[model samples]
Target: MNSRKKMRGGPKKFKKLELYSRISFLYLNKAFKNPLILKVAERKHKLVFKFLEKEQADVIAKYKNLKEKKHDEVGVRYIWTLWWQGEDLAPEVVKLCLNQLKENSNGAKVVLITKDNYKDYIELPPYILEKREKGYITFQQLSDIIRFTLLEKYGGLWLDSTIYTSKPIPKEYFDYPFFSQHTKWADTCFVQHNLWHGFCIGSKKGGKLVSFAKEMFFDYWENHDVIVDYLMIDYILMIAYNHFNDIKEEIDSLPYSSERLYELVTILNNEYDEKYFNSLMEECIFSKLDWHKEYKLSIKGKETYYSHIVNLQ
Candidate 1:
C-alpha cells in the first residue's frame, strides 16, 4: 500500500517540477521573447479575471449606493511602514530605508508598525485573525490589509519597508484623495497591465477607492482560504478600476509617477558615479528596492551604488 501511494505521488511531483522549470526559464529570459509564452500568459490572465468576475459583480452591487461618512479634513500627515518582527530585527537595507524615510518625512509622523503593536492602529475582523492564526494569511499579505485599512480609516502614505526615499515626499502626493505610483502598460510584465505600484500609496482619510478596496479584501478572505494569485493586490485594483467608473476616474486622474522606481536597483552593482546618482535622485523621490537580494557594498575595491546609498546620511 505504501508503494502504491508513492507511485501515485510520483507523477504529481514531476508535473510540479515541470511547471517550476518553465516558470524559471520564462523569468530568466524575460518571458523568453517567446510568442507561445506570451499567448499562454495572456490566456491565463484572462481566466483569472473571468474567475473573479462574479466577485467583482457582487462588490459593485454592494457598494453602488454606498455613501461616504463625513470626516474632518486631514491631509496625509502620517507615513506608515511594516516590519513584522520589528525594526530592530530588520535587514540592513530595510534599516537604511527607514532612516531615509524619517529624514525626508517633512513633518509627517513616521509610524513603524510591528507585530507587537499593529493592533493599536487598525482592528481587523475576527475571521481574518483566525485565518492568520491558521497560516492562511502571510505576514506580507497582512501588511497589505494593514495598509488599506489604515488608509481607509486615516489619511496617510503607506510605504513598503523596501522603498527608499531621497527627498521630502512631494506635496503632489497629498493632493489626491487616492494616489499610487502610476506607470504605462508597456512598462509592465505581460501578465500585468493597468497596475498601480502597490508598494507606495498615498491616500486621504475616508477615500472611497481605499474604503472599497478594504471591503474587497475582507470579502475575499471571508470566502476563500487560499490566495489565487501572487499579485492579488494588483488584481483587486484592476478589478476595481474595470468595474467602477468612479474608481476608474480617480486612478486615471493620477499623474504618471515614479516611472523609474527600480532604476537604482539595476545599477546597485555598478561603480558609483555621483553625477548620475544625483540626477536620478533629482528625477524621482522614491525608489523601490529589494532586501532579499544580496548586494555588494564594494565591488573589487570600487564603491558601488549600493555602497553609496548605504553610506548616505
Candidate 2:
C-alpha cells in the first residue's frame, strides 16, 4: 500500500483549453504589456508573432503529413509523444502541441505515437502490442515500451504531449550519452526511476543508457510481482541503468515517502503560480552539469525550455 501511495501522482493528459489560453496569454501579455508597449510590439513583436503563427501551421502540416514524417531521421533532433487513444480522442490543443514540438525540433521529424499505429512506427516484440490489445497493460506501460524503442533504435527526444516548448533543444545535448533528470521528489527515491520520467528524455539512439533502459523495462514487465504500481517501472530503470549491489538498501533510503505530492496536485489545481509547473519541468535536484553524479540523472542547465499549464481543468 505504501508503494501504491507513492506511485499515485503523475502528469495527466493535456487539455486543449490549457494550451490555447497559455500561449494566448504569453503572446497577448507580450504584445500589450502597456499601450506604448503594444504600439512598439505592433512592429517589434513581428518576429515572435510570426514564429507563433508558423508553429501552428507546422503542427497542422505535421498532422496532415504524419504518414510522411519519417521517424528514421538521424540525430537527437527528433520529437516523439504518445496519444494512445489516437486522433479521434486527441483534442485540437494536443494537435497544437505536436506543432509546438515540431517548432522546437528545428525541422527534425516529429511523430505522435498512438495505439492504432505505434507498431508501424516503433519496433517491439509482437507480444507487447498483443498485451496492450488484450487490456493486460495500461497506456502508460505501452508508452514506456514505445519510448525505449525509440531511444534505443533511433536516438531522439521523447516528451509527453503535455509539454509546450519555448526553444529547440540545444544540439550539444544530443552528443551526450543521454539526457534525463531525477524528479524533484526523487531525492527520497519515492517515485521510481529518479532519472527518467515521461516529461522529456533525450539520447543518441543506441546509447548505453537507452539500451539498458530497453531491457530493464522489459525485465520488470515480464517477471515482476503482481503489485500494479507504475513506480516499479522507474525502479526497474534505476536498477538497470546502474550497478548498485545493495540496490534495495539504496532505494529504501530515498525520501519519496511523504504527502508532498498531494500538496503539489492541490497547488497545480489552484493556479498557484507556474513555479509548480516549472519545477516539475526542471531538474530541481542540485547539480552543476546536466548529469547528476550521485543519482546519475541527467540535468538540464536551464530549468525550462518549455512550459506546462497544470490547471487547465
Model 2 score (lDDT): 0.47
lDDT of 2 by residue, 8-43 (tens): 222121133233333433454235344443443333
- Model 1, TM vs. native: 0.86
Q: What TM-score goes with each of the models?
A: 0.86, 0.52
Off by over 4 Å in 1: 1-29, 32-35, 65-72, 190-195
Off by over 4 Å in 2: 1-76, 182-186, 192-196, 223-228, 241-313
- Give the clash total for candidate 2: 7
Q: After superposition, how far is residue 149 of candidate 1 from its true place, in Å?
A: 0.8
Q: Report the Cα RMSD per candidate.
A: 6.0, 20.6
What is the C-alpha local distance difference test score of each model?
Answer: 0.76, 0.47
Q: Which candidate leads the pack in TM-score?
A: 1
Q: What is the lDDT of residue 288 in candidate 2?
A: 16
lDDT score for residue 234 of model 2: 53
* Structural RMSD, model 2: 20.6
Q: For residues 149-176, could you state the per-residue lDDT of candidate 1 as single tens digits?
A: 9998888899999899999887657767
